[model samples]
Target: MNNQASRSPVFKAMLETEMEESLSDTIKLSDVSHGALCAFVDFLYTAEAPLDDDMACDLLVLANKYEINHLKNYGENFLISKLNWESSLKNYSFAHQHNAKTLLDDALSLILDTMDNLNEREEYLELVEKDPRLVVNIYEAYYSKTGRCCRCHQS
Candidate 1:
């Protein structure tokens, strides 16, 4: 994850070192927790992750905010399955800011499916980083299915 942190856009993370001062006995960990990051990597590799609701929600927000589509999809799907609702607007804001369209779509889809839109959702169409290839693909597939040839209407 340290290696990944170096590779990804620096603006993507809220990385901070907060320490808990120990007054009495405390067992120290030999290594930092790899749980979320490892799960994220697994999601990247296989499009599958074994995450509980809370963990999946947390990581999905991070992944979406970080513009990590693969991880976001996997985490969102996991959360959808578990029906996690603690996922917040912070996730949506980051996703919108970073221009991760597919992830935002998946997240909104999950929200619709779970019937949990506790936070306000405004028109996110202002998130304007549309992928041309995705648009073309959707047009081709959808227009062809409807026998309309969407490209012809673009003139």
Candidate 2:
């Protein structure tokens, strides 16, 4: 377990440092769910996990946190494969939060493609309320792509 887990830069650093966790037999991760933890450990050992949408999201977070590039890429690819109009906004938000560049780009493309109905979605409203900067980024992407202003729709 130590050998496999050390493949992550986070675990490697933790184990190498003279910190309490380095001397301890058990380490605690409070933020992640039990299932995600298990899957993350399993992936460390086996290089794969049974990825669903929720698991992909969880693993993506974990992988990013731990600097596990392979696992992060795996999770991103899974989510990207499942991208759609209904889930694009939510996925975009998640991708943005996690700094998943490919997933963010893919989700943003979908959101841009469906901008006409963007205001109808509850997620869009929530995102506007919660992270309005992200919404502005959407408009910026639109303007950049189309060479037209978001409000006036003129180049």
Candidate 3:
């Protein structure tokens, strides 16, 4: 593959390097699933890939890892389009982990909008246990959005 076809710096660097994969006829991505690899390759060639709810996150991850800006944006937009209250927390966490700022903001907005019932949800409790900082971030976001501190209503 030539540099003109792909916008990914990772691919450009790999192709330019004297690395074994560059010299060899094959390049193996052990962590990527066959379907994801196929889709990633297809995107590199065509600048497009069919994305479903299940595939979007995976593609986003691959896009991020490979530093494919357009593909990453595509996946982030797809995930944002699919966002809902039920999946907001999970998506928010995924976005944070993946450094998808737009997706993170969108998911955080949904979570904040539903904050009245957030504590009652099992996911909220799980997040509290698994990543308390995320829950703190939610509260901080809430305060930032509302312009009110959590301590203001104290008795």
Best prediction by TM-score: 2
Q: Give the C-alpha lDDT of model 2.
A: 0.91
lDDT of 2 at 152: 89
The most accurate candidate by lDDT is 2
Ranked candidates, highest lDDT first? 2, 3, 1
What is the alpha-carbon lDDT for the whole of candidate 1? 0.48
TM-score of each: 0.34, 0.94, 0.91
Q: Candidate 3: lDDT of 141?
A: 87
Per candidate, the number of residue pairs that clash is 0, 0, 0
**Candidate 1 residue lDDT tens string, 39-132:** 6666555667777865676666666556666666766555445433344223444445555455445554444443333323332222223443
> In candidate 2, what are the lDDT values of residues 41-153, reduced to their tens digit?
88988899999999999999999998999999999999999999999999999999998999999999999999899999999999999999999999999898999977888
- Quality of model 3 by C-alpha lDDT: 0.86
lDDT of 3 by residue, 1-155 (tens): 66532487876777678977577734567898888888888888887889997678888998899898898999999999889999999999999999999999999999999989998999999999988999999998898888886788432
Displacement of residue 112 (Cα, Å) in model 3 is 0.9
Q: Candidate 3: where are CA atoms >4 Å away?
A: none
Segments in model 1 whose C-alpha atoms lie over 4 Å from true places: 1-33, 84-155
